[model samples]
Structure formats: C-alpha cells, structure tokens
Target: MTFIAGWLPSDLNNPSNDNIAGPDSVAIKGPTGGFLVPAGATVSNIGFHSKNAVPAKFSIYAIDFTLLAETGGATTGGAGDELFPLLTDWTPQVDTYVYVAALTSSYLTGIGGDANLRFMPYASRVYEDGFPNPFVQAGTANTPKQALWLDGTLAASGPSIPEADDITDESQPVTFTLSGNENAPTGITINGEVGSNLIFVSENTGAGTETYSYEPPLIADDDTTDLVVSVDGATAATVIAYTNSYDRDQLTHPATEAEYSENSLSYPNAYATTQPYEWKVVTDANASVVTINWNALEADDGFHKDVASYATPVANGSTTVTLGVFVPETGQAYQFDRTITVSDGSVVVTGEGLWCELFRDPTEELFTELFR
Candidate 1:
C-alpha cells in the first residue's frame, strides 16, 4: 500500500517565495499531471496548514471543474497550525485530479496580518502501487497559476421586507443589494425565478455594489418562497417570504358534549335544541374575512335540521353536524364535523296494568305518573 503525505511546494528550497498574499483571494492548486487519487484509492483526513491564525472558506473542485467539496469556514490557531476540518472520506471510481480554492477572511491586512495567510493541503491516501508525486508550485511561476488575490468584502442587504414576513400584497416589488469584490455574484434567483435588471453601480479594485429588484409572482395565499444569491455558483445568502392565509388548525368552535339527556315526557320528541354553537376560523392578521357555511345536520333517524340556526336538534340516535369555511385570500375552503347523541328519559313502562312510577330527572326533579 502507498501512503501519500501532505502537499509540498514544487521547489522545496524556495518555499517562502511561494506564499501568496491577499485579504479575500482564491488560491488553486492541482491537476498535477499525475492522478491525485487512483481508482479505488481511499483518501481521508483532508485539511490544510495555515501560516497565519485566520478564518477562511474553501471550495474543492475536480479537474473538470466539478465541485467536489467545500468548507464553509474554518479558523487556524496561529502560524504553523494544521486544521483538519470535518470532511467525508473520498474513494473515486476512476483516477482523479483534485483542485482547491481558499478564500481568506477580509480581516487580513498587511504582510504580517491575516491577509498574508497561506494554505497547503494536508491529506492522507492509501493506494496499491506507488503513483507519481503530485507536488506542484504554489505561486504564479507555473503554467496554471493561482487566481489573482481579490481584496474586498462580500455582503448582501435588504429585500426591503423582513425575512419570513407575510405578504398580503404582491404588487409591491422587493429589492436587494449585493456589494463586494469583482466577480462576487454570478446569479440571483427569487422564488425559483431568475432575477432581472441586474445593475452594477460602482466597480473598482477596491469594491463594487449591485442592485437587484424582484417583482414577486402571484402565489397562493399561505404559501412561502425565498430569494437566493449565489457567488461562484454557490449560495451566499437567502431571504424568505410568506403569503398571508388561514391556519386550519387554529379553527375554533364550541366544545362538543358527547351526549345530551332529557327527562320530561311532556317535551316534544325529536325537538331542535335551543343551545347555539358558534364556529370561528383563525387567519393571519392581514388575511381577508372568511365566509362560514353551516351545512345541514345529518342523523341516523329523525328529520335533518338546518345548521344555519347554529343549533342542534335532539334525536334518539346520533347526529353529525358539518361546518365549512371559505378563505378568500387563499381561495381555499375547510370543513369540520362533530357528532352529538341525545338520550330521552331512561325509564320505560310496559304491560296492561295500573302502576305508579316515580323517578328523579337530570335536574333532580321528582316525577310521579300513572300508566295503564
């Protein structure tokens, strides 16, 4: 088995001369003629060594420019610090050449500052049969030289509206501002729609700013979308927006009683109860009013009653009442149903015989009746 060590400068004697400098810069190294990873070879513990204690972001690419991996951000301890960030092991199906790009923090300043940060890949690989050394020069002296160190900051601001804010009106357009070094933003997508009218204001060696105005599409109420900004084909920032609508789970109604009991035989049978039930729906503050529809109550026996009166009729069997509401903002409707059972006086009399009955009612009323 072959054990490959960390990266080394092409010229081991003049190592200090190869250190690149920048506050925000991209450094690329690789495609070193020989395979960095042979087929079926396993590479692990991919990391880098830093000359300065500074935070940095890294993106790894294949020889064909396919993005392989990325380190969102990592920090070095001090000079000679080796940072082994958490990275998944890689076993390529075919021979591969890996390239790396490092973007140092903008906090770097002079030769001795964080801007003078230098990085070299440190990885271990296991492969059968030794391969050609992948060592290559670090600076501009080589054919595939590193990209010029960009010296500026990357930042984005404003959708004019706050993130995740509910929008009742779609006529109002949102705006965003992207400012940074040259070649900072490659594309911007709003709600999966590409943003148009990209206007660059100021562009110089120091910094540049661009503006993007987006007209939101008509989305179904209660739906959500987002705007994304990309740098070097990678997501840099995002802002989310929501459409005002109702929350079905928040619908409120009167508590349903499992059963209602009646004791007086003088009362009419299968009568509509005078008790009223109110059904209500909840929605975003900016949403429009909801129209409630009280459908007819359904029962196993007895006549169906109009629920528009907000009252349920008492019957010997179970009755189901359905309530529906339409939300104009979302152009959607919701429904809820409840079942109610009523039981008449629990006692029964039979046979042809003169008898006297006495029973206590639900309200503690004593009733005495003669049956024949």
Candidate 2:
C-alpha cells in the first residue's frame, strides 16, 4: 500500500494508444524526467517495454553521459507487453542521477531509441496475466508506467514509531516516534485509500530524534504508513514501510480521569471514563460451561449489556474467554472484548474485564491537549 509500485508505478501511465511502432522513433525522453537511486535504498524492477520490428539502443546513463546499462538487441516487431529487463547492477550512493534513453531503427541513425516504448524501469522481463502473446495488442498499449520495487529490509532504519504499534482505537491516542537513521520523509500516506484524513509532520528534536502525535480521535482510524522520498517529480524511493496493529477496538475503559485524559489527549467525561461495574467469569481447564457474574452499580453509556457475552467456544487447555461489547449508538466508543478470563469451566483462569490504559501519558491540558 506504500505505493511501492507493487501494483502500479508512479510514472506517466496512460494505457491507451491508437498508433503502433514501426521502424524507429525517439519516444521516451528520460533526460527530462530523470530519477536517482537514493543514498540508503536499493531500487529494482527498472525496465522498459517495446513494440518494434527492429533493434534499438535502450540504455541508462549518468548525468555525465556515462553509460550505466543497456538492454540487448531489439526483437522482431515491438509488440505491446514485450518487457525488456535491463542488465544492470545499479547501486547509487547518496546522490546518483540517471536517465533512460533509447534508439530504434537505422533511418533514426544517431537519433536515440523511441522514448515512447513504455516499460518497467529495467529491460525486457515480461509478466502478463490473461492477455494475448506479447501482452499488448500489437498496437494498443498505454504509456508505460515503469514497474518499481524497493527492498527496505536491507536499507538502514529511518525515522520510526517508538511505540511501533498504533491500531485505530477511540480510547487510546497514538504517538509516533522516529529515531536512528532518521530523515524527513518527503511524503506520507495513511489509509489514504479509505479517506481517513489524518496527516501531520513529526517534530525534529535534534539528536537524531523526531516525533509525531495524533489525538485518539485521529489515531483511531486505519493502521498503515507509506513514507517515500522523491526520485523524480514522477517517481520516488520508499523510505519506510510500516504498519502498527493493536486492540484498537478492545473494551475496558480507562480507570481514572487522568488515565482517560492521557489516552484521549483530552479531559474525561462520564462516557469516556471507565464504568463502576464488573462482568467476570471463571472456569477450569477444559470446562464445558462457563458462568459469568454481572453486577453494575451504574452502567456506563459506552458499554452495551446485550452484546457483552462469552465470545468463545467451550474452554480448551488454558483458553481465554472474552467479554465482547458492542455500542452501536456511538461506534466511536464501541470496543472489542479485550478482557479475557482463562477458563477450564470450573474456575475462571483469568479476569475477564480489566483494561490497562497503555498510551503516551499526558501532562496538563494546557500543554498536551493543545499540542495534539
């Protein structure tokens, strides 16, 4: 989801063409829209596509006109979907600039290859699904958006979340911390697919540390991060690909006003605070029937009595029985059953309903709330 071009690249792609390739033409102009491999990342799957009947000069070069790589001779007719993977050991340091250029046919002698032979970033490597031979319809193919791949596993760590796990939850806010190998990512997208509008920059606090804070309301959404640095205006190298998942929807409200305030980054009201009630169950190992004790001096609005039930099958060996709660009125307050009781059926193995507020602690309203 980080736009690794796993599914689609960020290059100029318009998959529609009425004209076909013949002898030769200078179609693609990489020198204008150039790209560079960043300092700490390894980029791959860089190739080009073609539909030609003759050979061509498809090559990448450094800014100094140094030839870095070149694909083999051209095929018969440049059929659509004919991908050519370049033979490249392309590894650039902090700032290595490169461009792709090509020449097709003899009449176009001295003229570079057709720049319009859209392709993956590299040379002829074809991957087609449910399509005719040569992938393209001989004459119909879109302006190719180069295929892109980045292996961040090897790249040194960049600014990262200190807590590393921030699932969407109403009760708990998320604090993202980045330290070590830190750099300001050019851009970030968070659940942008689902229209969850929450974007902010991390504060760069000298000493290789930066931080970003999201109030619970904002943090309680999707859980994915796509960070990237610009390669060219049209392409980029992924900086950090991260995802944090926790019991964002788990029930068991905060214990105190301070706790609620800390998790939500705001003051606590009656609904946000934990309820003064108990729904507990105990069972022995491998118990068939589990009994739950329910006593509510005052039922909190955030808890739904009907939906709170034993949400697991017969107790297995040291199994956990969950107390599931559903508050449909205010889904923001809806919580999955985080409270679990270890049960065999005869006695409760663990307490079924106790939530620990595990979020960044908040200080006073004047400082913390305003910051969020």
Candidate 3:
C-alpha cells in the first residue's frame, strides 16, 4: 500500500555520512557504460540533479541494445532537482539497461560529486527488493542495500502489499526473496493470516537468494491475499498473494461470446474505466443454503469486487447474478472464474461457471458519436 518511488540509490563508498565515498558516484551516459536498471519494471519519469538547467538526451535500451524509448534534449537541469516525464511507460521485460547522454553530443557534463539519476517520473508501489538490512544503531550509517525511512518517524514499516493477485492453486508455493541476506526470516503472513508451517530454502538449496515459501492452509473457497515476511520480529516485506485453489479448469474465460450486456448504464461503475457483467445460475431448492465464490486466475481477469455466491431466495429454475461485477479495491480483472456449491448435509456438488469475456470498462461513446 506504499510507493517505492524515490531518488535512485546513491552510489557511495563509505557507511559514514562524512567519509571517503565510493568511487561509483559519477558515470558517463551511453550504451557501453551506464547504470544497470533491475529488469521487469515500469517507469514513467526521469529525475536527476545537475549543476545548472541544461539540455540532454536520455534513452532506455534493452539488453540487446534495442532502443526501447528515447527522449530528445530538453531542460535537463542541475542542482535544482527537476523531473522529466517519459514519452511512455517503460515496461522492461527483462534485465534492462539505461543510457542517458547529451542529445547534441554524447559529451555528458559536469555535475555534483554524488550524482544519481532516477528514471522515475512518478512513485510506483514498491515490490520487496531485498531483505531488511540489520537495523543500524544510533550514530551509525546504514549498510549497503538497507531499508529506508521517510519523514518524521511514527509509522508502520515493511514492504507494501501489491494491488492484486491472480491465484491459481489451493496449496500454492508462495515465495518471497530477500536480496542477499542469508539469515532466515522469523515469520511470515498472508493477507494478515499467518501460515501454520514454513519452508525456508535457498534459491537453489545452495547459498544464494533466500526464498521463503509458505504453504498456507487455504481452502478451495476463492481467496486473494497478501504475504507479509517478518525479519527479526519487525515487518520487513509484504506482497500480494494469489491464493486460489490449485485444481482448476485450464480453460480461460471465453472472450468471443455474447453473454454480456455491453455498455449498459444500469451498473454503478458502467461509465468508469471498468465494466461489470451479469449472469445467472441454478441451485437446488432442497438445499438449506447455497453460496458462490469467484477468483481471477489471470492478471487480465476482470474482477474488481468479490461477489458472494449466495443469491436471492430462489425456489424456481434459476437466480440472477452478475459476473465480473464485484472487484477488490486493487482493480478489475478482464478474465475470472466462478464456482457454485450447493449442500443439504447429505450431498454437495460444486460446479464451475462458464468462463467468458465479461464487461470491460473505461470505454464510452464519444461526444460526436453520441450525437451522430
């Protein structure tokens, strides 16, 4: 629930605030030599400090030197920290590379000794980048790859939970990795629900990235959760858990179907970015009670809210229900799945709902088109 956005890490040489700093403070901008950006992330802006307001060119390149995104020389200034918006959100698929240079010439210039350029226009929710470094004692500087604090203290500390998760299994092997710390985690939690048993294994059973795995006793009932990893009894890292049943129909929600009532204004969130779809299912009247639950198996599954399986008292052929209607605050899923269970203490039968394209939102008739 917090943003990982901020200035990039300062390449330093010493732990003390005043000491011989690291030699990695400055670098020339180009394809051959530049700061290496951790792969698989989206960046919107670039902020850096300069001696004075000047023009420069910044480009983001792929591992293969493929020019993914580039910007022309503009007001790339100095000292006065300025932020520049990127032309588009850069989603580097893999370990990406960055190239910041002068547009007129590759002659990158003079600036502060402790110069650092961050390709973040706006703040992004931080994923657990590393394990908590042993908290520094008072009067001591932070260690390399240590967690940071913001503003005057008095606040909860740990990794921010992600917006949403796509659960695909019942006993899913949820794992969180600490950067390079070998110490085992003290505890872990998912969606505030703690795990009964934990298995800590190295990235490959050898001395490597510490991956904490949790086989939380989750039921078949659809549940999306968050994983909270505790280091030294203090909240260190938290991530969203895609806690869904492992056993599921491989078939995805059909996108090419006419099951949804498109563009209907009846729903509360129709005009907004997400659209909700409706459907109906049948349950036995003899059953004392019946309830329904759903989950978005894929990232594209449009599930914005959680709609319980229970419907209005129906003793007839069918009951009215909405698909892709309910969603978590995180956002909507374009594809999702549903399961209906009916029981009367004697027998219980579970059925999977038809997976298909439900309502997609943020689409509206244009002003001119409406008149036309």
lDDT of 3 by residue, 1-372 (tens): 112122233422223322111232221122323333433345555554444444555555443334666555586544544555557766543333343322323221222221222221111111133211111212112111211111111123233222223445535665566543345666766566566566765554332245656666443223435556666545665445353433322222322223222311121123122223332122222333433332332222322222221232223222233333222222333222333332232212222222212222222332122223
lDDT of 1 by residue, 197-296 (tens): 4444432222234454554554334344666666544564545654533222212211211121222111111111222212222321111211113222
RMSD of each: 20.1, 17.4, 20.0
TM-score of each: 0.26, 0.25, 0.34
Q: Candidate 2, which ten residues in sequence have the lowest lDDT sum?
A: 1-10
Candidate 2: tens digits of C-alpha lDDT, residues 293-326: 2332113323332212323335533333333232
lDDT of 2: 0.34
Off by over 4 Å in 3: 1-44, 47-56, 60-69, 72-82, 89-99, 105-182, 201-209, 218-222, 236-372
Output the lDDT of residue 73, model 2: 63
Best-performing candidate as measured by TM-score: 3
